[model samples]
Target: MGKPDAEGHGPAEGLPGLPPEWGRVVVPDDASALAVEATQIRRELRRAGSLPGGHQALGLPLVVLLVAVLTTLAGLLAVTWPRANRGADRPTPAPWSPPATLVGRALPALDLVDADDAPVPLRGLLPAMIILLDGCPCPDRVGDALAAAPSGVSVVTVTGGRTPSARPTIERQARALADPAGGLRSFLGQPARPGAATALLVDRAGLVTRVLPELGTSDTYRNDLSVLAG
Candidate 1:
């Protein structure tokens, strides 16, 4: 009726609308999504190519960093390998020596008496020193420092004595006495000064090498004695 069909060849317009195979093939929703994603990807890739160098600014920096790291590692291994295979050495300093006059010197001849009523000859027994005080503040300071010196070096404390009681007390309290020249007035020449705490630092020899004015420097005295003893 409507144009005979197809002269035994086909059904007019090849079977109305779509073919049977086209009807059977169903396009999924994911296919449309994939086409949209592909179009977006192509556009982005085209935009990226349109840029100045068609390359990312961060790519060159990464490449440079990698190269620098590789170079540093190689150099470190090259130098360190030889050093690890080899060895190192160290040298020490020379020993310290004391003064010339002090070394190998003779002991002094200082005869003294201790609190025990015993006659203690200084220079004969050990390397000794005389801590002479004017009997006031100097004696107090000297007493505190040499309180421990009786066991070590001979501490002959000679103070200017005024009264009979004072002389006995000093003789009894002190480790030793050189020669108690009676009276503080007579010994220190009348009015005594502040620091007549004159300490004669004598070595093994009878000679007085150093005359200390004060007794506050306790460590220095010990160090000197230690050096002398050594």
Candidate 2:
């Protein structure tokens, strides 16, 4: 501009038109400024790399929530599974029937007293024929059936209540017994209906082999007894 400067250069602001050798002055401040600019650019790149955006940021929390939900459902299923299976596995019991035929069933304990007030242990009288009749005066047919029962079978007649006079007559035909407590009805699992004669045939092992219900004539009693003997 005004005869250039000492090195034939105009002003520093006119650097675009300067010769290459004249512009080659080393400046320590320029290198420091460039280093600072480079550091700022590196920092911006690192911040962009570290920060997650869009779906990547949402996916992490979603995965954690999914795991937690799945775990909760699994825990609930484990607790209720056994109770559901237990109710499904249980079986209902069969209904009870009165006078349930005791044939082929073990005879329960029967402790009775004879007409003479002696204890008659029914279990001890195994392989015997027991005739259960209504209250005494024992029927003539029942007494006759007990007397006519085949050999090798001990016969005993059980009455519901005590009858002092009927005992002697009944004992003449068979061993007379009295269940003052009405226990035989409970043992037979049957209600006491009038004039129903029930005969139980017990084997040597204290198990009842046959149950005979007789509401008919004397011939029917004989036939039932004959079958019991064999």
Give candidate 1 misplaced runs (Cα > 4 Å).
1-122, 135-140, 147-151, 161-174, 181-192
Ten residues in sequence with the least summed lDDT for candidate 2: 24-33
Clashing pairs in 2: none
Report lDDT (Cα) of residue 192, candidate 2.
Answer: 55
lDDT tens digits by residue: candidate 2, 1-230: 11223344443232233245443322221223336545754665566567777356555645544444344334334333444434776788754343556767887787878767878788777667777776224467556665567875667778877741243344445666778787766777766555566677787677777666553444655655565567
Top candidate on lDDT is 2
Estimate, for each residue in 1-230, the C-alpha lDDT of model 1 and write its tens digit.
Answer: 11222123321222233335433222222223335545755665577678876558445644544444344344334333443323345456554322345424444343445444455566664445556555444556555545535344555566443211123233335444534543312322233346546555555545545545445666667666554444
Candidate 2 has what TM-score? 0.47
Model 2 stretches astray by more than 4 angstroms: 1-101, 135-138, 162-172, 221-230
RMSD of 2: 28.8
Who wins the TM-score comparison? Answer: 2
The collision pairs in model 1 are: 106-204, 106-205, 107-204, 107-205, 108-205, 108-206, 161-183
- lDDT value, candidate 2, whole model: 0.59
